[model samples]
Target: MKKLIKYGNENSQYGELYLHDTNCIGTVCLFHGGFWTMPHDLHQFDNVAHELLNLGFCVWNIEYRRIGETNHKWRDVFDDATKAINELNNIKNIYNHVNINNVFVVGHSAGGHLAIWLNSQDLKIDVKKFIGLSPILDLEIAYYKNAGDGSVEKLLHGNPNEFPERYLFGSPIKLKRKNSSELIIHGNMDDYVPIKWSKLYHEKIRKFTDISHLIELEACGHMDFIDSKSNVFDVLKSNIR
Candidate 1:
């Protein structure tokens, strides 16, 4: 069973905590993707969370502020991401059964962008690994390619030339790489987020750390990687190390 914990008063500022009964491996902070919009929520990763629980890992399926919400801004979404991770200790203290160790951050699509971005932050948490599923790695490329149906423009509120600071700070590719091992899984047939972005990100980041890997799933699309029923899930399990 999962428990709901609120980090902020807003409707979007909470996470579902799933705890395993035995052999608690560690904590997995899971974030979903909807191009940083409200059309999608944390429910998208319920299956993945359950799988993680079965793997003996506690899951924190986080829901952060989205662009479509009232008075929402990209900055709020970023702030909420940090807030959610910072709240992990509180959750452990409140629920005596909750034990968090060897943290792993995982996100899909735009959430993948958030995962890597959060890793770059000097947070108190010690994340063992970072994983991106069909993630939007490069914001500049995303802006140029006009990925996510102009969602990137809508996210930063303008073009790279208009708001260069936002791109420089918000984009994972632009941030300095962390020492933790990172895994990127993208589908070859993905139309929503180009696989080339993943490849480019991998090529650049691999120079800094040899532990990073990019796995391209054949005949899979953007959504297939998150679907537990898909064969891509098996690949995800094998490569999570």
Candidate 2:
């Protein structure tokens, strides 16, 4: 059954946990991407959650504070993400059947950036693998290109030149660690987030660690990565195991 649980004080900071009734292999955390803005939330991952459950994995669909919300700050989003994962680890106490280890994170667009960033952090909970679907991995590039209608500036409250430390703290490209494996998938036709971002990021990270990989989908667009019926979903499923 799917259950909603709070991991933070604010209403926006919560997650929906999908617990498989039998033979659950591990946990998968889903993060939705809306360019760090208010228009997106956990609801975007509903279909993905069910599909993960069917694949013998429990799902945690997370929601974090975004810009345009009260007391919203970019760091708060990171804090909320950390809280959600920590809560997921403790969820095994409630369900008893849920596995705390072998946790995988799947993120889309902006959320993919966050997943990569989280994987790089020094957190108490360990993430086994990170899957980024069309992530905005480079904040400096996204800032210079004015991607997402100035979403990066809005989140950082300034350009990368003005807030280099913030960009260093937030950008997955800057924060990537060699501890966990990461697979980045991008559509060749993605107009929202160009395929080059994933390719460049993969190239950069691969130089330091061999665990990073990139997969480019032909004729696929930005949103196709999240579509369960799409070929991208098959690619994602094949990698999850």
Candidate 3:
């Protein structure tokens, strides 16, 4: 295992990444949930990686520039995610154990939103499936619902009014994939992100694809997915295989 940090253009360095043997079943690029803020990354998913490694699977826990980590951080959350995926592919070439045809991503909350968006993205990596735990995939709803602010949203799509194209292009919800490789887990009683956010994304996704599945945790809250308050880990582990 090795902990590596990749530097960015602005003297920012992506945080510690845990890379185990590359010759496992598949490479899972994990993104931790932090709502584009700082103090969040792959460290929170240490237990998940532990469970994954115990199951004889190769895993890569990724961390990148978050809101608090850099001075110019904003919409770079998505950029970091796509960059991590690309980086995973580069090292994967030598190992030859990574399932090139079936790479997986798992994320929580904001990370969940990122994981699903990665699967839907038009990037170079070939994503087999994505496990999203309480994902914030629908940006349009978050905008009108005041869940996300101007500065936070602007970092991604820029000014929504001044650049409608930017909004339309940067939003994964506004885009479509030939097929959805997604497994979404959202709490039915989530007060933070609201269940409707996942609902709206699911509804929009079904129009274009057929492989989206959502697991609604009854009587659960937003943070419960990664918290001990709920048995979300069991659910997440069961789906990992």
True-vs-predicted CA distance for residue 3, candidate 1, Å: 0.7
Instruction: Give the whole-model CA lDDT for all candidates, comma-separated.
Output: 0.85, 0.87, 0.69
lDDT of 3 at 105: 84
- lDDT per residue, candidate 1, 1-241, as tens digits? 7899999999999999997655476788998999998779999999988897887778899999887888877688889888998898888787656656678888999999888888678776777888899998889899888787888888888899999999998988878887778889999999899898899999998887786788888998989867887898898777553
| Model 2 lowest lDDT segment of ten | 81-90
lDDT tens digits, residue span 54-103, model 3: 66566667776666554554456767788877776665665566565556
> Ranking under TM-score, best-scoring first?
2, 1, 3
CA error at residue 143 for candidate 3, angstroms: 2.2
Residue pairs clashing, model 3: 75-155
Please list the residue runs of candidate 3 whose C-alpha ends up more than 4 Å from where it truly belongs after superposition.
5-22, 68-75, 94-101, 148-151, 157-159, 178-180, 227-230
Writing each residue's lDDT as its tens digit, candidate 2 over 1-241 gives 9898888789798889998876489899998999989878878878878888988998989999998898777688888877888887578878888876778988999999888888787777778898899999989999999999999999988997788999998888887585888889889999999998888888888888898889889999999877888788999999987
| lDDT of model 2 at position 86 | 83
State the weakest 10-residue window (summed lDDT) of model 1.
93-102
Model 3 residue 165 lDDT? 69
User: Which RMSD does model 3 reach against the true structure?
Assistant: 2.9
